[model samples]
Target: MKRSSFFSVSLAIAGAAALAVAVTAPASAATPSAATPDTSGVYSVHPIVEKAGLSTSAVTPSLTPAQCLAQTAGRVACQTPDSIRAAYDIPATINGVPAGTGQTVVIVDAFGSPTVQSDLAAFSGAFGLPTPNLTVYYPGGKPTWTGKKTQTGWAEETSLDVQWAHAVAPGANIALVVAANDRGATIDNAIKYAVDNKLGNVLSMSFGEADNLIKSPNANNGQTAQGVKALAQGAAQGMSLFASSGDSGSDNGAGFANYAFPASDLNVTSVGGTNLWAGSGLNQPRETVWGDFANCPLTCAFGVVGETGGAPSLFTSKQGSDVAYNASVYTGVLTYLGFLGGANNGLYFFGGTSAGSPQWAALTADTIQAVGHTVGNVGQQAQSWASKGLLYDVTVGSNTTPTFSGGYSATAGWDRPTGWGTPDVNGIIAALK
Candidate 1:
């Protein structure tokens, strides 16, 4: 979703029938800077907290929408326990159940983060959540990558997804199957890697690119049908694949497009984005809503980003963004990105359906643990009325901006950007039956 000096072709985003709406943008919105990592700490802001009830402490800070782009660009990296609680309606004291000692959830992503283990500890400790079954599987960390800068975006995302899911569903065994890079054959290999190793039941993927040309093995397309067939055999063994629909929408981030991969695969669950409003300690009836943003067209100053380029999906619709959670920059968790220019140890905000997908995966673990069942092929049940109603059905608000042609507005019924809304922990557990 790069934004530095940009321009985008005005796509009519015709006849998706299910989701076309009029587009809008701020009056004075400048063509956003190519949306990239915030080397400047403008987006490095956090909620002001204290040893007290909700105050200015819980008050979410503000940054221009342009400054917020980096948060979702990588992977939804700042997913903290509190965000999960509001987004899921899981009780404050999730220690009610035993740690997920036997169940399993495997996270597949690019690269690895150095502080994954310690960060897990801090997140779990702060909220009194259970410590989940956790392990890492990289086979090798790619002796080539040191995991610096651009690599950091995807690497940190991988760490946050694996750890947060494990923390929320502590009793579940969590394994991380790592890939060497964010592009090329590496990601495909990572997915196959997880499948080959028999990492069955509940798998998660948080990134990818698009291949608009009719499928070609060398063109970075999805698993070949034969490959998909083999994966289906794995799914028959009760394995479920979950992937982020990508930061870009249906147009493939060339402004308003969506990317491919496991997300595009019919056999997998495609998680989407949402803007959620949670009352940290408000204690009133909390309300949940859908969140999706529109992208701006490309401009010469900031060219269409490679990751954000490529054509629309060749594959037709699948059931995903089968579900969603808070992936917007404003309602996201806050953390500290490494300080730049030896300035303040910069604090920042981050979230994307990247954060939400793993959150859903972890909730599945908790439900599996609670009900003691491993109902695979969750994609079907996920869209059922039982599951849909169990979810929060985030129904308010919509993304309005000039850059994007495809509108991500929330209508009365289901929307493209966020499928069946987010999960309602208690209701989701009940719906599992």
Candidate 2:
């Protein structure tokens, strides 16, 4: 049976759960701004109303480090012990979920961040995050990136994943699994390594090549299959894998549910993006939803202006997403890129579903704390969204693809882009058991 969508799928949580309070920045040699500020600091971006309308509140506005730390408590996890990134948010202790402390989260990425320690520390410091559960290693101890163009990009991507996951689940230990290359096999093996070793209770991956996640073998077979199976094995071992659905939207590769590698493995969770929003309640709330207009017909240029929804995939298995969180621009994280050479670059601004993937991973840690169990069977667990109050109903937005199928417009119910809507962290905790 080819399940067409994840909309009507359902599931259940067996007990009571709750989340503990939880919880970036800047500079450049750069130019004068006609705008009020350059916004190259993590603390500057306003809280989002929605990430492609997937969640109602993604960003937490500007909070002092003390406040963020006070909120998360033991869950103030981080890849680095930096101060800049900590001010944004880092729960002091990931005490809510049933997993308790000492659990681990494996962050899988394409390359290495030599300065991961320093950058993460800065990220933590700025956001007021607690020190990470620690223990990081490049797969084989030294991954061979070959210094590809994408290496640096994925490096920053890696930093974001580990730093944020730690911030949200400070009490949880983090194991970063890196690969020699981004193309194939090696990365897959890294996933397996995490699984085989019982490295963590949750796995968060941000790299993908934009392919049908489950159906295709991608470029590297044996290794790829090993990775997929590893993730599945991890799931069976009581771990949840959070894979980033790509930032390109439906237009990625062939468009519509075009998952990249592990995200589409069917065995793991294929997390998509949504326009994240935030504010007091609802009406007239300060919000920012997901949008990425690919170049096409009426519009010759692709940009962040029109694609409010997100990419979709009819190819993905039912309940593919499980749930979605903020992963868009406008409500982006500000930081100093410096001038190249890794974290020292003049300045940098990061957004995309990459940020949301780990945030969800960390939240799941909290859910585990509250539920007393690490979430397995992501598809089944995510289905809990249908339980009502489990998620913030995403009621708007759309993915602007050059050739979008169906109506593709965002509406009141579940659609391709923002599946099952955003996580009601508190509600999820309450429902955990």
Candidate 3:
């Protein structure tokens, strides 16, 4: 299943669960903009909203970093930038050099968020991080908001991408390029515009379409063809493209084994998900492939049985995922989403590979700052890092489900669920430097 669609289906199944505790919209709640169409059926924005046990009357009040951590008892755990930095062993300064001072990370999403700037401001203020240099561009055209679920979903995704990218590399400039719609051409044009204009060195894509949708009898769709060319051009020009593997375990939502496009495309670095557990003060103690079915409410709102996307690619030359991150919503990152409107305002928890891609992009910006040059073809760079034993290999967990015919499990080295596992940021920076 493509991520956005997967989340939609999950929400439908758990609609009752959400309603039981969903926060009530305010009387003056802003009307959501029009929904983005799923033209490719594969390019859905990836942000799994957890609606269980939420208040129905008012937005959760702002919480200090300490307060947020204190509420993590049988509730969704919200991570701060300090915690992520500590968990990943990311240094305050790398090689006596600062991180991502002048570098820019470009985030590509559909139906740009109307309040991304304000949302990012809230997020930085909450975490006490410096405000980031940010810009938003509509390469194809301004999105048409039909007041559909797609619009709101992508708005959340935009918030997740911008906030976390800045969270990881606070000094990096951010350029958000939103496609007019989810149509393949529109998205490709947005990406090409970013590349042609040299907007940023790292491009973070938190959306994907199923590879099977573009293969065989449907080959003429030309959905992924143009995007592939643009990504290749970006890579050749010393840009790093990062995409989420997906939210679906292995099934393509049509009950067949498949991988997500763009991420499946070899030119991009496919980031997978992981179950990350941190000790007191956000010290990372245990990390594994993020296949937690029992704790679905915390990580996913879909009926239990959600897993990280992992499998052999039926569409591309390279394997599925190249790196992993703390994508489990149970232990998800906290980001502000002012665009949601009403009681859904303030900090919210987000999971899925959608949360991971931008984090990796931020990490890439940090790497570029450390190396003093853009590291082109991040997927290839991941391979180099893996060879030098720089990655934390996850040897447990499986993405298999009785509902899906084909799936992969985490193994000794590169397996489906966790690819080369998560990166050791300090090690990656040291090795690349």
Candidate 4:
């Protein structure tokens, strides 16, 4: 049976404010920039709840764009691993090749998930994918959930990272490194630990703060220094780091163009988001730089002011995302997060650059496996491949918010919103080869 036949039947179901500051001090007496806790301290994780209610009986299911965006009986439609592979033109097997068989993809997050292993087992089983050789490491210490918001949020983020990375590269091993706390210093320690231990060749980081926030008067230089050092060390070890560009568009809740940190760091491949439409079986897919500005007027929570992230950077010349994938809640991806309260043992729809980062890392694992070795610099390799037309370039849409005029729009080539655009796995593999 063609999976496309079920696409329509499956289709029926689916689916912040800030303060100002005063500057009255002299130049020398000016306060040092402190990291903005709202934007820079902890990464933003956006979970979309069905307007109806949460369900425990619904298993993880894949939905097409038509089914996911429908208003009536809005089911939790999200892209499944197979749907993603099909949409991106990734081969079921590379030349009957066992790509990523022995490779490792490491995921770093704060305050580990207690049910990650079990949750992953269920996700893989539902999809008929192999169980990953997974290991959870806590460099600081095991997280004490204590029902804290940060802990719970990280637990959800951890599940998204692990499942999606495995989904993209089912053969690769995964190392999940969890920080004891959500502090910049604690997360930095976890990253350094991963680098020092040579945990993996590709690392996916879904947590980040706004770059401008980190440059605030209260910013911690020590934490920033440590983060920079860790990136250098990871690169030196042949590890390719990937971080989410963020979900708050350009404003980042600051009513201005504020880029997310770590993502803005030069050593990392910053991934943005997109709205993907997987065409029928064997039909070509279509994608646009993810922005929901047009649909925000009546149905949007933030009205018509929301968008994906893209802005100038204070840290490096690479000003925006290197690539993108489905990150909008309206065109979300499916994952199992049964650990959350009120979430039955069912699947949920998730969007944001958080979803994009891990999938990119997983694809990188495939590239490494195809090349039979880790690329010295995955970010540079991606650019080179993109130049050769190994990626799908998105030329439509913009990540513009109502108040921020500084955001970039998608154009013919690399733009701030989606740098080189989305990946073409086969083309990338061939280019890397």
Best by TM-score: 3
TM-score comparison, 2 vs 4, better candidate: 4
Weakest 10 consecutive residues, lDDT, candidate 2? 1-10
Instruction: Report the number of backbone clashes for model 3.
Output: 7
User: Model 4: per-residue lDDT, tens digit, 53-147?
Assistant: 22323323453444433432232234777788877866556546444677888999888788899888888887767877899998898877774
lDDT of 3 by residue, 1-433 (tens): 3333222211111221221222222233121122223454447765866543232122232332234334433344456687788778776555554467778999998898888898888777766667778988987778776548578888888989999998888888999999988776788888899999889889999887766556532265565677888888998888989999887676545455667778887788898888776533445436767765422434233344246776667766756788888887666776776765685566566788889899989988898888788888777766678888878878767665545646777788788777887877888888866
Best by lDDT: 3
lDDT digits (tens) for residues 184-255 of candidate 2:
566767777888887777788765554433333443445555665777688778888777655544544243
In order, the Cα lDDT scores of the candidates are 0.49, 0.49, 0.70, 0.68
What's the lDDT for residue 271 in model 2?
Answer: 62
- Candidate 1 lDDT over 1-433, as tens digits, reads 3211212211122221111112222234344232332222110101111011111122233322222222223221223555555456664333465534456788876666655665565445444556645687775465255646455565457555765576566667778876665543555566677777776467776654343422643344344443455457667777766766655444443344434555666677677665443533323223333223343221111221111111224564562356666664444554433312233222334455566667667777666666667767655666674345776565554443335555455544465556666677777666665
RMSD of 1: 11.3
Q: Could you tell me every candidate's TM-score relative to the true structure?
A: 0.69, 0.69, 0.83, 0.83
- Please list all clashing residue pairs in model 3, or write none if there are none: 24-56, 33-147, 34-145, 34-146, 34-147, 35-146, 42-209
Candidate 2: what lDDT?
A: 0.49
